[model samples]
Each structure stands twice: as structure tokens, then as C-alpha cells.
Target chain A: MDLVNVISYSLFAIGSFFLVVAAIGIVRLPDFYTRMHAAGKSDTLGQSLILLGLIIHEGASFISIKIFFIILFIFIANPTATHAVAKAAFLSELAPWKKDGGKER
Target chain B: MFLQVALVIVFSSIIALYRAISGPTIYDRVLAVNVIGTKTVLVLVLVEFIYERPEFLDIALVYAIINFIGTIAFLKYIEKGGLT
Candidate 1:
């Protein structure tokens, strides 16, 4: 109805779109490495956007501060966790998927 | 409005759940679980707004921390083939 509500709703829609993209990516990507790219980047962005919308809706308040902390945690931890998983998989000798269907390198 | 958004997120989590359940490798399942965890956080926030209960954000914050820790622990186990 008002400007704030409009902005919050639009942001919520955009965040949801990114979240769905990440989910589809995890399901459709050909390999673990590619899936990590999808999950790590899109999920972080989606969650941050949604949190931002909630913060805007709430305005200045303790809850907004808490939401901000959650955003910070997600920004820091999501990629770190993704990297850890990828590193473990690499260490375990998992091969990346090739476009030409070549043998594991 | 927020309810619709929450429903969309729930649907996405179900899709991620499929990957978690049927992934070809353990890493894929780990990644899907991570995605699902993040989505759950967003869903929690949405539910908080829908119910006018700001306190649930505390639970969402805690869940985010736990999700990150769990992912790292899973990776460590995979790398060492055990959790020692």
C-alpha cells in the first residue's frame, strides 16, 4: 500500500526468486563443484535480500539488529562452509564433471 | 503476502530436499542440506513477520550458526573418513 510495504514486498519476491534458482540449480547441475557454486552464491544473496527486506519492514529496532547479525553470519559462514565441502571432496579425489563427457581427470 | 512468500520458500526447500535425498555424491547432499538450511532461516523470518512475533528471529539466528557448524563438521568427517 505505502512505499515501504511496496519495497518490502518486491524485495521479498526477488529473494524468493533467487532462492528458487538455487534450489533448481542444486537439482539440475551436473556435478558437485557446479552445485556448490549455485548453492553458495545464490543462497547467500537470497537470504541476505530477504533479511534486508525484513529489516526495512521493521525499521530501527532490536529485531532489525538481530536480523543484521544473521545476515552477517550467513555472508561469512555460507561461503566458508561451501569451500570446506569442496576442499574435502577434492581431497577425496572426486572428479569435476566435463562438458564432453570425458573420463575423470 | 508473507504467507505466499513462505510457501514459495517451502516449495524450494522441497526441491532441495530431493537433491539431498538422491544426490550422486555425498558433497551434493551436503550442498543441498546447506541450501535447505539457509532457506529455512529465510522461512523463519517470514513466519516471524506473518505471526507478528519478532522473537523467532532469535531461533533463526541460532539455526544459522548451527547450520554452518554442521556443514563444517560434515566436511571434516569426509576429509578424514572419520570424526576424530
Candidate 2:
């Protein structure tokens, strides 16, 4: 494969790895607060990296242009959504998961 | 390559679905939906490339917008028990 192809594919692989890892975290993590870490940063980074790879592959096309905007919007929008969800959960007085035998905190 | 990634993501989304269904609280379900939304956007983009159809990009962008707005609105309603 060409050098550009190699780089893009490697990026794609790494990005997908992170994406799957984060999903597993969402499934396996013990708490909503803990799952936020998995859902927020890692997911955004993985999606961005994959889109970045696509940009490298497309190279100055309209597709790349649209992808760039999508990445920008996602970076801006996801954190806002995550924060809103967390805040709403907190405000509702949802109990945080306990470590010392799942008893009331 | 796009197909493989798409399949993996679809699988990941399915795993996330387990949490959505059995989650101890609404926040977990909302979080799961958010995760699934991200997956949906990426899959749309990948499908565009895989099928050589450019129009899917616009759909992907629109989906992203709607997902963000929907999540925010849902949180607001949940937090205050009203849209106000």
C-alpha cells in the first residue's frame, strides 16, 4: 500500500480500537460517573482520529471539508451534552454508586 | 476497511444496549443513547465511503445536530420535569 493509505488505515485501526474500548467501559463500568469518563473523552478522540484519517485520505475534497465540520461540531457539542446529562443526574439526587458494600451513602 | 469498522461499532453499540436496558437509572440510559448516537454518526460516514455515495455526509451532519439537540432537550426536561 501507499504511504498515505498505510497511515490512514493505521489511524483507522487505532481509532476503532479506542472506540470499542470505550464501549466496553460503558458496559462494564460500575457507575454513571465512572462511565462518563469512558463516554466523553475517549469516544470523542476516537471519532476525531477516524475523521482525521479520512481527511488525509480524501485530501482537499468536499467530503473532507464536510468531515472537518462534523469533527469541529462534535468536539464542541459532545462535551456540552455530557455535562448537561451529568448535571441533570446530579440535580435529580441520583445516588452515586457506593464502594463499601453498595449501602446507602 | 469501512465495513469492518462499521461492524465493530455496530457490535459495540449492541453491547451498550445491554446497559441501556438494564441500567439502574435514567442517566445510564441517556448516556447509552448518547454513545449510540456517536456510533450512528460514524457509521453513516463510513457507509458513505463504502458505497461511494456523497449524500450520506449531509445525513450524517444532520444526525449529529439532531442528536446533540435531542440530548440537551431530554436532559433539560429530566432535570426540571418540564421544558421550561
Candidate 3:
């Protein structure tokens, strides 16, 4: 309806779309690395956008501050978690999916 | 509108749960959990706004922190063979 509402609505729509895409990627991707790729990238942006939309919808309040902090924490921690998983798999000698039909381990 | 979006997120989480259930390796499960945990946070935020409940925001914040810590801890134990 208003500018703030319009902006928040669009944000929600976009964020939800990315979330779905991430989910699909996780389900449909061939290997752990690729699944992590989808989850890591899309989850970060999608979740942040949703939270940001919430803040915008709610206006300036203490709740907004709390959500803001959550956004910051997610931005830092989510990627760290993703990288840690990938690195651990690499160290463990996990084989990747190959295009020659050599499926993952 | 917020509720509709939140439901959509929940549906996405359900779809992602497929990976956790049938993932070939442990790390894939971890990845699934990580993605689902973050989505849960978003749902909580939307629930708070939709229901006019302020306390849910607090829970959502704590969940975000705990989710990160859990993921890191799992990875550490797996990679190092011990938490230390």
C-alpha cells in the first residue's frame, strides 16, 4: 500500500523465492559441494532479505535492532559454517561427483 | 502477506529436509541442518510480526546464535576427531 509496505512485500517475495531455489538445489544437486554451494549462497541472502523485510515492515523499534543483529551474525556465521563443512570434507578425502557418471561416495 | 510468505518458507524447509534424510554423506546432512536452521529463524521473525508477539524475536535471536555454534561444533568434532 504505502512505500514501506511495498518495499517490504517485494523483499519478502524475493527472499522466499531464493529460499525455494536453495531448497531445490539442495535436493537436486549432484554432490555435497554443490549442495553446500546452494545452501550457503542462497540461504545467506534469502534469510538476510527476509529479516531486513521484517525490520522494514516493523519500522524503527527495539525488535528491529534485534533482527539487525541477527542479520549481522548470520552474514558472518553462515558462510563460516559452509566453508568449514567443505574443508572438512576435503580433508577427509571425500570424493566428488564426476561428470563421467562417477557418483559421490 | 507475511503469513503467506512464512508458509512458503516452511514449505521450502520441508523440501530441503529431503537432503537431510537421504544425503549420502555426513556433511550433506550438516548442510541441510544449517540451511533449515536459518530458515527457521526467518519463520520465527515472520511469526512474531504476524502475531504481534515480541518475545518470539528473542527466541529467534538466540536460535540464530545457537545454530551457528552447533554447525561449527559438529564440523570441528568431525574434522579434528575431538572437540578439544
**Most accurate candidate by DockQ:** 3
Candidate 3's docking class is high
Model 1: per-residue Cα lDDT over A3-69, one tens digit each: 9999988998899899899888888887888888788899889878988998898999998999999
TM-score of each: 0.95, 0.95, 0.95
> Ten consecutive residues with minimal summed lDDT in candidate 2 chain B?
B75-84
- Which ten residues in a row are the worst by lDDT in model 2 chain A? A96-105
- Residues A20-95, model 3: lDDT tens digits: 9999999998888778879889979998998889889889989899999999999998999899899999999988
**Clash pairs of candidate 3?**
none
lDDT of 2 at A48: 92
RMSD of each: 1.9, 1.7, 1.3
Error of 1 at B57 (Å): 1.2
DockQ, every prediction: 0.76, 0.75, 0.85
TM-score of 2: 0.95
